[model samples]
Target: MTGLTHHFLKMNGLGNDFVVLDLRREPLALTDALARAIADRDKGIGCDQLITIEEPRHGGDAFMGIRNQDGGTVEACGNAARCIGRLILDETGKDAVVIETLGGDTVATRADDGNITVDMGAPRLRWDEIPLSEEFQDTRGIELEIGPLGNPIMHSPGVVNVGNPHAVFFVDDADAIDLERSGPMLEHHPLFPERANISVAEVLSPTHLKLRTWERGAGLTRACGTAACAATVAAIRRRKTERRITVSLPGGDLTVEWLPDSENGPGHVLMTGPVMLDYEGDLDPALLSGAAA
Candidate 1:
């Protein structure tokens, strides 16, 4: 760990916390234990995920590597992208940036509306893409019913992979359910070996929705970027919403467009939102050491 220096930035996208580390020039190596150690709030600088910006690979403007609090790597993180985009822009003084993540290449544009628009790319709805345990001819809606909620009430979920596996439960009341209590169960449900982000969403209109989430690996979060994108896709599939919709999460509202590629539709879903800088600091060895100890 010699010659190690970690400059960190604290930021949030609707309260989905992140510890931003600039590794583009420093090239820090990350391990799960190290990630956990640094994410310890009481003993270390806490965050929901650790985001490292490194040299781009395969012809993207920038590259972002995301690790969950439990020390697992995940494909997409909406809030972090905006924050990282701003960070990169501040450093490079550019308005738009293309970065690579484990899932795929995503485009982020710093809009004048004070919102950053991230091209989340087209959603993958095939059974294998959602990567369900088995095959489903039509992935628009699959079956999984939790009793009491009714065997048929919540039976079918419109599944999709918006960079990460997601199962959306379109409910009538986004607030009626106890997300904090139910989120952990659904997130780790056997159906998704990779685990999944659980969303309880209520459609306010064809172009509007309200959502609350229990994010896989991160538990109940104020906002989940992929979840919003997935929900929008699901809503469109069910004919509940149009291609472009306003998804309101606990953190705030995100403008999500499905990008159908039709003459009147979009080719890439655009997620427009904001990232706020809460603070800035560096990780001290003492903090990580204490967490590990």
Candidate 2:
């Protein structure tokens, strides 16, 4: 793979940054090593995830493949969707765009406020769907607690799968707990078979929430769109917040709206946020060696 050079766009949704490589026309083989090389903060194009745009196999505009900084592939990444969607919209000059991912299809639209809105599809609430190691009648409050017996540091978290697994821990303060310490513990707990994104959420009001996420593979991130959606849905399920709410993250705010299921259709989660293109550049020829050498 020497002498190979690929052009990439650096983009971000809120602060969840990504390095997007369009391989729709010129396909390039991606491996875990290459993904890690691309995401290395000091040596390569730094990003939380490395996104690849490929020709759509289904009826969507394009397909997006996501790899975390750890070089692990995942089902979904909501913030990456908005960034890639904005790219497609700019190229085609269309208000709406469709993107296919390993998780499922996502529909994105350019909103009037100059932001992107993505329909993340319906969340998977079943225990098996979230792929927990065991079954639970109610995922809203699973029998899981941390710290001591009488005085637990974090308790019964709501679990959901918005394309991927997530565990939302509602707390009085989002920043009080040390996510770097607790996240890895909860994420690898036996309860979650496929592991899970760990979120510490504090309800600010009926319509507002403060959230922080420890992404499964990326660790602590400034923002996570799917985490926000999962947190909001978890809050609503617990009667802690409204269906539509604003979630504040370290990077910025995202508006999430969950429409209830009806006879006509199923439930859907819509996340709205901003995407910015930081720059465009070509990959160093030497970087690809990490994939094969």
Candidate 3:
């Protein structure tokens, strides 16, 4: 753990940034405390998540291990997938690549428009799959509220598990709500056993929606890819928007599409967005050893 210097790439998708370390060649024993130090903005690289590119356990191009800013390991990350996919595609000179995560294998392809589209795989809609504390016969709208009993500020959020758990509250105006205050409370709601990502969505039209998200472990992010996919599916399920629509987040826009179930098999959610490389640097040994906060 001491005297270790790791090369990392700083990347972002719609401003949800990450500090990516390639562990495929030289493995680093990454601990939770070390991850937190690496993600620290003041003392470390500062990112929403710390991404490690490891040798694929499954039959894929590479494995993506994600650690939130809090240093907790999570299952999936849509934005991180696209970023890693782009790196793999560029490294291997391939049009498409499969990135493995704890959630599943996500397929990222080079779109004709020069963006990356990630197949987030099939969403889990069942109550147990989303794994609510109690069983709600219908998950489209659950009995959760944010205010007084009679008059609540928010209620009946549509829940979906796209890679990870999410609850989308469709509202008239997404910007009107103070997510900074409500996000943390909702993310730790007792109903969500494993906690959840909370999103406030406003349907602008059949093809467009505005959204803001309180990420589970990352707090209020400029953009959250899985949240976008979850919101799009929830909107389509509620008949509020078309299957394919543009979701505008605080950082930028992402296109999400929920393909219908057909003869091929179950449907999958696709998220397309732009990725950017900000910079690359080496992690200081003191930071990794928790000597620097």
Candidate 4:
């Protein structure tokens, strides 16, 4: 915790912000407590997640490690991929780079218009893959609900695991529900043993949808790229939308496309969006040592 301070980049994808540390060169022993301190809004750097760039284990360009605000590690983050991709692309002058994560490796390519497009691999639709607590014949709609027994406020969510588990409810109004209240409840529901990201989506048209997500470890998020991907895949499976669509979240819009299964391979989900660099600074020694708060 002593020595030279570590440098970090503050960035966001539609307000789903992160504090990124480059651990590939000068590695730091990042503990859970330190990660929590960095994510604390008042006492620390403050971000939805803490990201680290490390030496790739799978021969990819770099490995992206994600830790939620709660200091728990999880696999996959689409927004983070874009931000990291931009950094790698800028560093190497490459049009694309493969970002390795615990969930899988995603190929991030520079779009013609300057946006970044990440191939988030394929969505996992099986019950066991989603890792539901119990078996279900179909994942298009699962038997789970909230509210009174006879009448529920929300029910039958389309469950899928883009990188992590998510249950997306098709709702009449995306903003009507009290996500701050219901989100935590559904995220911890028994149906999801590993917990889940809860989302309320309203289909605007065949190619557009409005969404709000209660990210699993991060709580209510301004935008969740994986949730957006999950919602689009679920929507397409339900015949509620086309193969490709624009998903608008509280922070901004993300274009998500579900590539259909072709002769070559299975379908993959593509997410394209903007990334922003807010600032760059070194971490305070006190903050890293648990003395800042």
The C-alpha stretches of model 1 lying farther than 4 A from their native spots are 1-5, 149-153, 262-266, 290-293
For residues 1-293, write the lDDT of model 4, one tens digit per residue. Answer: 55447899999999999999999877888888889989999999999999999999978999999999999999999999999999998987887899999999999998866789999998998999998999999999999988899899999999999889999999999899999999999999999999999999999999999999999899999999999999999999999999989999999999999999999888999999999999999998878666423
**Residue-by-residue lDDT tens digits, candidate 2, 39-144:** 9999999999999999887889999999999999999999999998888888888878899999999999998688999999999899999989999989998989
How many clashes (backbone atoms < 3 Å, residues ≥3 apart in a chain or on different chains) does model 1 have? 2
Pitting candidate 2 against candidate 4, the one with the higher lDDT is 4
What do the candidate models score in CA lDDT, each in turn? 0.82, 0.93, 0.93, 0.93
TM-score of 1: 0.92
TM-score of 4: 0.97
Off by over 4 Å in 3: 291-293
Model 2 lDDT-worst window of ten: 283-292
Ranking by lDDT: 3, 4, 2, 1
Taking the tens digit of each residue's C-alpha lDDT, what string does model 1 give over 137-173? 8877787765575443455777889889998888888
Q: Please give the clash total of every predicted structure, in order.
A: 2, 0, 0, 0
* lDDT of each residue in 21-102, candidate 3, tens digit only: 9998768888888888888999888999999999999789999999999999999999999999999999999878999999
lDDT comparing candidate 4 with the true structure: 0.93
Evaluate residue 251 in candidate 1 and report its C-alpha lDDT on the 0 to 100 scale: 83
Q: Model 3 clash tally? A: 0
- Clashing residue pairs, candidate 3? none
Residue 1 CA error for candidate 4 (Å)?
2.5
Better of 2 and 3 by lDDT: 3
RMSD of each: 2.3, 1.0, 1.4, 1.3
Clashing pairs in 1: 128-131, 259-266
